[model samples]
Target: MRYTLFFFLLLLSACLQAQYKINLQINAPKDSIAYLRGVVFDDKNYFPKDTIRIKKNVVILQSKKPIVGGMYYVQLDKSKQRFYFILENNDNLSLEIRGGEIHSNNPRNQVYFQYQKLAKSFEVIDSLYDAEVGRGRKFSYSDKAAFFKVKTAALAAFRKKALPKLNPSEVLHIYFSALNRLDASVPDKKNYAARLAFLKGLDFNTNKLLFIPTYKELVSEYMGYYPTQADSLLKGVDQILSRVNCQSKSYPYVLNYFVQLMRNRNVQNNTEGFVKFVNTYVEKSSCNALSATVKKTLIDDAARLNKVVNLAKSPAISLPDTTGVTQDLHQFAASFDYTLLAFYAPTCDHCQKEVPEMDSTMKLIESRLNLSLGRFYVCNEPGVPQATWRKFISDYKITTNAKHVELPSVSDIRTQYDAFSNPVFFLLNRAGEIVARRISPNTLRKYFAEIQRQRMAQNP
Candidate 1:
């Protein structure tokens, strides 16, 4: 009797060791369409209720309770079909496929065949698209007509089947691909225009996938080739901007693009229109803070241009001097035919190299013409210990001719000037208006010459 009891205990231990135990529970609405739970074994699907024995790397899932050994599959009521899988103990495993067949469990031969077919299709379609777009035809159908035909058919197939179901990211890919196809060599304006019109009509608000790239493309095209289409482009942009509700995330990119377009394009003929558009949009925009800042920037920029236009008639200056001492910019302006306001940092390498060059130029121009140079240190390392500030000043020998002063409000100065980088130079006339600004050492000489010419013309 003692031997038989011992044998029974050993048998129980062996049975428990062979079984892969799993616990499952359902915590979803009863009206769910479908629910399933399974474990992955060597990338194969294993239902918890199945009788087939699973090997290593096996996952076990169930619909109701714990399942002991072999894999098993469970189907809850079609309605309220949600289910979850749980591991009972520390089992080396991963879970997948709550509702469908595990693709990896397909026989290795079938997997190989599917992959080969996919690769061939991808290669053919990719080649056709590239050839069609790359053909140096003035018109779409002029060169590589055969390739274009193939590409069109393939694209249509993709759009009809995939576009409706595509997520935002996928839609963006399609839009970008279409844009890439619109090249300078393509003579087919009608086709390109139609494509763009279609993209413009896409529901960017509900599907954010194609919004940014589409906006960018429209901006580029407007600036590059379609100045005549400004009204239409602006309308499209207004619609897009309305949908971008997240200011902190989206405003910078959109604003930067607008600023670039305004700066690069000669939109003066449409200045009134542009200004009205900005004012109306700014008033309606959710980007109140950004809008205010941009408006100020635009106003200041316009004011500067007005000063330049009135350079000969009204030359006046009111900028602050070093030591926070207010000086009539006109004082330095009239004394020197050309004045350079050097914004620099003592520790900046570019400043170190630039200051001496500026000093040499000042010396060269001083005798032949009335020229003055004043340096502003733009103390970037503000609030440092006094000793550190003094040491930095001394190390750079900044006192030679330049005046040193801490910015009255460093934050304000940075924001006002947009001074993210160091060693900036601004050229001013007798009117204290900025004639030019330079960041590169190479460009400084050219700007200086231009300023000198302008001054001579004014004085002559």
Candidate 2:
């Protein structure tokens, strides 16, 4: 019995020692809460993960539970003083702050410290250039050229000196290498290839690159680059995916980022691209990086998009009016040259603002084109109380002539229409074909005004 008790104590000791532990010394007063934060792609955002109070000298943070490997920051509670570190499960770390420099026994932190120094130095020079421009200081062509040359040389020197210090086998080395930024003013950047080429070469086998600002900057550059039309954007997303390993965290991040990016865009085939991206890259992928719930949710969203997406025939919808009588959408649309369908939730802030504008725009359309408000149809999404819908209608002062319809609870509204991001609009021609989608109130006014002017010129 004594031997068994001794063995249990030994096991407990081993279990306790196998935890992720860190001894950190920061420049703060006694009992201050030091927050352990996960660094997001934006270096400015340090999302707090855990916190512990600081002892007089060192704060030893430990958890028997595993912590995922990621770049993180240590911040004093409500203070600007912070430091960054790359951490992994069960990593033994010892660090101290002295004379504003971090002293660490961990070799990885040592390399990251070098990287941070070089990065900060580059940023200082970059910010000076930005401030010069922001101040509206004008530079001659030759002067600007000289500044570019100097800036490029400075970056090159920083990289060259820091290159030998990084071990090639280390994952931190790969992350550091991705931190190099090229001047957007360079002529090569006019081509999409130049913007994405740097990120394409990174070692995505390690997801450490995902947490760094450099990778995200290049990603934003590539995504936000000019000619951001549907095909170009889709191709840009594909290029990023081709370079990243499907098994890595980068796969889902890139897939979901671009999918959501293109979802709201009014460009032609943007919805198609959104669907194809999620289906082909993610649904077909064998990697477990993306959660099943997220994958299913995105897939279901893509399906909903297909229902009312631009250029598709408007699906058959029969909804009840505020008077407890049902109306057929196709039959109502037949009486008009065009039907404007608006789906909105009563509580949606954007819907509340837009619905009023829509009513005023309809009045303008009546005055300008001699069209009646009967052509406009405003729909309240299913599942909300009728009182909320009535309140929205009353608050917005919606026109009586227009059809104010409500999709009943336990209806096909979810399957037949997209009320996902409420206040979505679609312009349908008399043939029940979707002519334009997400048509705003202002846009509707402008379009009919253009048509009215063209018709007047034709008659004149």
Which candidate gets the maximum TM-score versus the true structure? Answer: 2
- Kindly report which residue pairs in candidate 2 clash with one another: none
Worst-scoring 10-residue span by lDDT in model 2: 180-189
lDDT of 1 by residue, 1-460 (tens): 6457545644654556633333222232332223344432211333333332222222243223333212123344543322222222223223333333222222321232333344446577667666755783333235544455555554445444544543334423344344444332233334556435544543323322223234455434433333323353465456556655543343555555665444322232233334444555543454564656777776665444333334332233234434456555445555555565555565667667766566556656654455555544445544545566566666656554354545443454444344445655555666656555433333445455566798889999
Give the per-residue lDDT digits (tens) of candidate 2, residues 1-460. Answer: 6457545644664678756677676766533677788765557644567776764555556667765466777766656567787777778788886544676899778867765665666676678778999886876434565766765666556666666776764445555465444343332325657555545555544566666555566665566554434566777777777777877766666666676667754444466667777777667767666778987888787777766564367778777788878887777777777777887788888888776777777777777777654444545566778788788778778754567777665666645666556787777777777776666775576567678889989999
Clashes of each: 13, 0
Instruction: Give candidate 1's error at residue 313 in angstroms.
Output: 14
What lDDT does each candidate get? 0.44, 0.66
RMSD, every candidate, angstroms? 16.9, 8.5
> Candidate 1 — worst ten consecutive residues by lDDT sum?
101-110
Task: Mark the regions of model 1 whose C-alpha exceeds 4 Å error after superposition.
Answer: 1-173, 179-280, 284-335, 342-377, 385-404, 408-426, 431-460
TM-scores, all models, native as reference: 0.35, 0.63
Q: For model 2, what is the error of residue 237's alpha carbon versus the real structure, in angstroms, after optimal superposition?
A: 2.4
Q: lDDT for model 1, please.
A: 0.44
